[model samples]
Target: MCKITEELQQIAAELLKEGKVDLVLGYTKGEQEEQSVPCIVTQPEDASKLIFDEYSEKALSKYLLEESFQDKKVAIVLKGCDQRAFKLMQDESRLGREDVYLIGVECPGMKWGEDLSPFCLHCDYRTPAKEDVDSLLTGADIPEAMQGEPLDHEDSFTDINRLEKMSKEERFEFWKRQLNRCKRCYTCRNACPVCTCRVCVFDRENPDYIDRAKDQMAQHQFYHVIRAFHVSDRCVSCGECARVCPEGIPLHLLNQKLLRELDKFYGEYQAGIDEVPTPLSHANADEPDFFGKEGKA
Candidate 1:
């Protein structure tokens, strides 16, 4: 175990023993080797289960939004991207900072099996600000292969540009092929740390919003388009949407494309890095009308 893991366990144990937190949310070994999964430690003895590693990829902050967490103290382990999600939740008034005890960890760059995850390769914030967390842990056990300098923001779109450069018809066909494979599992929505809707449109039985049918191509397209628009401005580029997608859909690409346009229009904005009133939250009088509709709502 790394020093950070030991410190985290100690902190969690003390907090639980002292009744500082009702639960300590962290990671423990999964059934398989090298697999870390989210777990809760309500007792001081269970604090030994807490560990931080590259395989600890799940975003745990969203659990704070659950009904069971109401009016209760929660100590959650947060990586850089997860910290951004927590910040966004606070900005939206969905979560109160006082109720959460943030145990922030310096991410060593997450991996999917032996390879470094695509999103972590371009990850900007490897560590959270000390002021932002209740307790901070650093000195993550970094793999030598991931020790290089982080990728530049502009150069981060190397893979995304390939799809953007395609012809309009080509892009349509490409999306159709990909979306056709979608089972409408909604894993992307569930895994999204920023998708905090209490009652998702898909979950409701109202027909006016959308039907329960998942077989239609329009149904698939509609789901993605609405979700993409909803999170366009707030996405932290965590890549959880793409990571947890079972169909291997590059769902992160849609959000990244929207974020790129928002950046171009609004001039350099990262969701949690910057203040509230994100680009999509308000429109400028001089805003470009993509649909060429003028003087109309």
Candidate 2:
């Protein structure tokens, strides 16, 4: 058991005992599995079940958007990426600040099989010091070894570099090949925190963008392009899309490409910073002209 769990449980119990929050949302070991899943504990006794680990991958912030949690004071556990999502939700008015009691934990790079999520690998905000958090818990103190040092922002673009080395036609063919394997299962979109919508345009009944034949090329272009565009400005690069893909497609590559382009074209802007709105969410009349009139066509 992590020491942080005990501290977090103590804090949550205090909150519940004093009626600070109605429910405490945290991770607990799932029945019949080694992985952890989100659990809501209303009673202090249930706080003992709370746990956290690498398997704590599901973004707890996802619950904020659900109708049931509205107008309830809920306590939530947050990793760095999850914290970003929560901040974005609050900024966009999707979730009210008063309704949430945050318990932030310092994240030490969660590991996927071969690669880490782009957000975790390049995270500068691993320590949870957000003003909204009622309390914070860490496995270790802020060590001199960890403090004052810059985060590792080394580019994880090995795959992107390889693709860039290819000719334009070759690069186009590569993506077409990869996307042809898509089953239109929508696992990627469903897993993404930013892909929230009442009804996704992909599955709209009357007006269909995809054809019945599902032309392999059209399928690839439509799904990937639409996914990329929708998340271009808002993606936190959590890698949930690629992690949930059944076919093991490198969907993060497409996301990273868009992230790189946004950084280059606009400025260094992260998706869910509370102080700054996303670049795509706002327009400036004095924007630079990358494509001059002569270069337009």
Candidate 3:
């Protein structure tokens, strides 16, 4: 086991042995040696199965939304990004902060390939807040030399400066080419921690809002655009949606674009850092409407 994985197992075993929490959520080795999957431990002995490493890329926050866990005191392991999702759930009253024990692991950042993920370069929460956590563990921090490096995935938009330099037509063609491969699998939606609707519109028997008949570039664009707008205010930049996409779609770029627009018009905001209302939540009487003129069209 990796050093962090051993430490996590020890901590989880201690927590379970002491009856501090009824369940422990963490990562374990997957079918592939290079991949990891979420595991739930109910017994102290089972805690030994937990592991953590660069391959533990999936966000475990969405598990808390299960009705079975609402009544139980659960202990969960969180990376910097996962903590933001938990925070959003707390802010929205979807989960009670007091009922869960958060074991925050100091993230060095997860890797996509030979380099670090793009989201890690922009992430400010390498560690969770001291007061909110029950226990904090110092795990492997991303190496100093690799700290801000971006994984050079063909679909990477980490160079926001380069993307911004493109003409309107160029940008349109770029996205059109990228989004054209979408199979409408909803893997992105299922992986998102913030997408907590019990009955998502996409899952409805008759999704009137969107064409359910067949997959067209128009429908593909429609699905992604609407989903992007829905989570713009709530996205924590966890990057799970993009990571899970089988088509290699650069979905994080959509979230990043929305975040940039929000920052530009609303004077900067990062969701789930605190309990502040999102830009789309409400408005003050005296607040300037940067979008008012654009709405006329």
Best by TM-score: 1
TM-score of every model versus the real structure: 0.94, 0.87, 0.89
CA RMSD (A), model 3: 3.5
Q: Pairs clashing in candidate 1?
A: none
CA error at residue 121 for candidate 3, angstroms: 2.6
Better of 2 and 3 by TM-score: 3
- TM-score (C-alpha, index-matched) for candidate 3: 0.89
Give the per-residue lDDT digits (tens) of candidate 3, residues 1-297: 556777889999998999999999999889988788898999999988898887787888889989999889999998877888888888878888889999888787777767776667556786788776888877574677445644443334455557779998988888888888788889999999888888887777674666554547787888999888889988888788888899899887888788777777777776778566778887776677656666655
Residue 66 in model 2: lDDT: 84
Best by lDDT: 1
Candidate with more favorable, higher lDDT: 1 or 3: 1
The 10 consecutive residues of candidate 2 with the worst lDDT sum are: 140-149
- Please write out the lDDT profile of model 2 over residues 67-157, one tens digit for every residue: 8888788999987778877888788877787778899987655546644445565567775566757778888333343446444544666
Q: After superposition, how far is residue 295 of candidate 2 from its true place, in Å?
A: 11
RMSD of each: 2.2, 3.2, 3.5
Give a tens-digit lDDT track for model 1, residues 60-149.
999998889897899999999999999989988999999999999999999875798868878878788899999999998887756787
lDDT of 3 at 199: 84
| Number of colliding residue pairs in each model | 0, 0, 2
Candidate 3, residue 24: how far the Cα is off, in Å:
0.5
